[model samples]
Target: MAAITYKCPNCDGGLVFDPSSQKYHCEYCLSDFTQEELESLSQELVHRKAEHQEPGLREQERREQDRREQERREPGGAGAQPVLYTCPSCGAQIVTDETTAATFCYYCHNPVVLAGRLEGQFRPDYVIPFQIDRQKAEEIFSQWIGRKKYVPETFYNKKQIESMSGVYFPYWLYSCRVDGELDAQGTRLRTWDTAGMRYTETTVYDVKRQGTMEVDHVARNGLRKANRQLVDSVLPYRMNEKENFSMGYLSGFLAENRDMEKEQFVLDVQTEVRQFALQSLQDQAGSYSSMQVRKKEAGIRDEKWSYALLPVWTLTYNDKARGKIYYFALNGQTGKICGKLPVDRKKIIILFFSVFLPLFLLLMTGGYFLG
Candidate 1:
């Protein structure tokens, strides 16, 4: 596997994608390049990589091959293996699991994209790049934390704030057309008083509705290892704003490859679509005093599936004493936020006592004066 990094042509420093400016920036020399300029440079690097091979990289590949061979010889030894790649900037070994498609080198802090992991079928068709930058995300997090009274201080400290990361999560987008019909019975009641007597009438009518609906961009998480609730709560990225997938967008962010396939979600998505269509037809049955649905039929066709990468800003805190993990996530495009924060029990107990103690003293003094 080959690890790739974008280097600034002017200063030869590591380049990272800047969400605020939508450009590649070199932090060392403060230089920025547009996508067109970087495309040419990347092509040149590709040619150079094909021609030259580093000795350290060759050694790492040899070791990996040996490890695989040994695993094959041993029974019940085949399992997930770590991959190793040499960082071009620092010449240090970068270790990653099979699912990590993009990450930062621990030694040099330069972003590295594992090209092999994103090749062929694993490549995403569309990507929603991070619209909320690190600074904006941090500001939003600070404001949210400030509103809470009993949250622990350690959860929003400087170190924890810096640990927040921008990640591109894999999702499967589904679109389809549904043809549906619904049959129902509706009833209306009429009551009146005439000549000092009560009269009542009930009328019943048969209702039928038919329509076609086109549903688009129903997204489902594609990585099985990801926390479904944490990611799903921050939804709804602007699908209309999604751009064509470009490796450049993955430069500064961590990205994961999909472990779950579209086939896995096929039945669920189809059922959801059918239910939605039936509900729409039912709603069109008009306003009646009472209604009962008799039959509903829906047929789905022209199904389309596309793999996409959506952006999110995430922070996690592990409460080791409590054996629990808390998460904070924000939608990268819409600025929607969701979090599970840890409350400080000590702070709550102190607050409870302080308020009641003052009230209790006031009550006792008032009673003494009355007596």
Candidate 2:
């Protein structure tokens, strides 16, 4: 469950983080509070879990208490019955996922970040703030669809365009130094002609090279329910710009803890770094006409892992006419957009026949005249 929503000290209104201002804002009273101030006011709520445990407990009881606390600290999808917390301003019960870090109240539109959701192991190490605000996202979405010709006009309705939100997707960034060697057989062809007889010979040579490479951030998105393909299409965040994690940054925006473990993706990270090392070695063998890799050896000398939140603007359009859904995603930091676009079948067929029929008739008439 979320710790609780922060209440405005001046007007008793629910406070929300504003991405534009990068501070908690109260529309009711026009008051602004820094995240530090809010944290100070709600520091006691972080220990609310301890308030429920019994003062004196047996060994098994203490272990059970510890396990329960660990479960609360971890991120997961709660059952359909979401844990509900009452909005401090409106007393409205706010339903949320078990792992959600921040959300806004539906009744009062008060944006609140769950202070406890970002505590301990659940905390992110770095965060890339939303560089592209929602207003810019709307314009980018408009320009993107305007360039796509075959999309049904209904797909760009005002409602569909306005539904986008800035979400910080969870990711694990792995950095490591890799040193490896690659072995390959490279072939170069030699041809010669003498006394009207041609002879061709192919020379095969053993090739090997050693190199070192550093991978700063190999990112893996964390939400299990999010479409991996769609999420990955907007990749390659600028790790150089990431800031140390702060719950204050999450106030106005949506953020979440990772649902997947880093161990689950360790092999994938290893494969990526190894592939880079091997490819670098192969690039050195450019003189060969063709090469086949024979052996590979790679190892990570040092490994570092960081939990981060990367920004993404996503929109999914359900095309009712074709009974298919099209997803459009943009990198909130880079403004990169990618998705599948549906083509108009009827228009394609008409254009094909219209252009082909004239050419076919002209060829037939010219043949008859020549005959």
Candidate 3:
């Protein structure tokens, strides 16, 4: 397929898709067109209307017809351009009409992506482009693996470590305002004296509490198989750096749409929201010698949700003796790293006996001798 380029109607300068506004904007003349207009023109040339027409094909036929009709309104019918690509190697989806000289697969770590297949099957809203390039990622990975004394030496070598990728993991970000109210019993202890004897008394009081908090950008994992715990451990991404979505920045990297829907993540989000509400409500209770929450009610409201692709780098290594896999995760955006590694049982046992045992014996000998 030829490299396609969209030209502006007013000035004929090159036009590019603007993800922030979801419009095609011409950088030269500043003319803007909706994505529908741009797509209709590009699809017109390839569409020949599927071979067999069925009886109940009315709905599909109508939508197709409407799109075709809009194509006629486009300025250039025959010369419209395409702006997306698909990776044949790993099924990575991308959008960049310009040649991506080099590309890597996020899932399979393949270096090949056929240029022809990237004809607009998948698109992304925004991309947090690779701030830490491949070399930087390797450096970070090595420093991380070095701290693991029991990690196999082979795992940190160049050949094995190059497989590390700067992948944009998918996620769903939800922003909402929360309001909650809770009631519980609070207790306090007091001492009383009667004649020569003293007795202890317990006092209980009714405690009522209410609180409100606004949360911005609570993220839920969009990849079902992804370990949320691992993702969270590397968190505190610089959310302010996030850009509005666009396919252009995905030119040489790998990304995927959120296969998991917003509804599927509600249960997980509710769990976090409840914990946040509980903490805020507890703070409002001021000072209580001890408090037991017997009954609780909390709620979430004014929620805004959207699918997002966040960045992460994962490294997995095998431990021979235990025959279990250990993994480490790095937050691609903020560079925070966290994960589990192999621990040497022999070293642990030796250290315990060599250090702690002698210290314990010395303490006992001193107590016996000095007593």
Per residue, candidate 3 scores C-alpha lDDT tens digits across 177-232 of 77888788898888889999999788898888877778877877666556677766
Give all TM-scores, in the order shown.
0.89, 0.78, 0.59
Worst ten-residue run, lDDT, model 2? 72-81
Name the candidate, 1 or 3, with the larger TM-score value: 1
For residue 282, model 1's alpha carbon misses the true position, in angstroms, by 1.4
Question: For residues 1-371, could you state the per-residue lDDT of candidate 1 as single tens digits?
Answer: 56888888988888888989888999999999988898898888878965797879868876765664455336456525676789978989998875788999999999998876676677899999888899999999999999999989999999999999999999999998999999899998899999999998999999999988999999999988899998889988889999888888899899998878899999999998898899888888888899988988999989999999999999999999899999999998899999999999999889878998788889999999999
Which regions in candidate 1 have their CA more than 4 angstroms from the true location? 47-79, 192-198, 360-371
Ranking 1 against 2 by lDDT, winner: 1
Q: Give the top-scoring candidate (lDDT).
A: 1
Model 3 lowest lDDT segment of ten: 114-123
Q: Pairing residues by index, what is the TM-score of model 1?
A: 0.89
- All models: lDDT? 0.88, 0.77, 0.62
Candidate with the larger lDDT of 1 and 3: 1
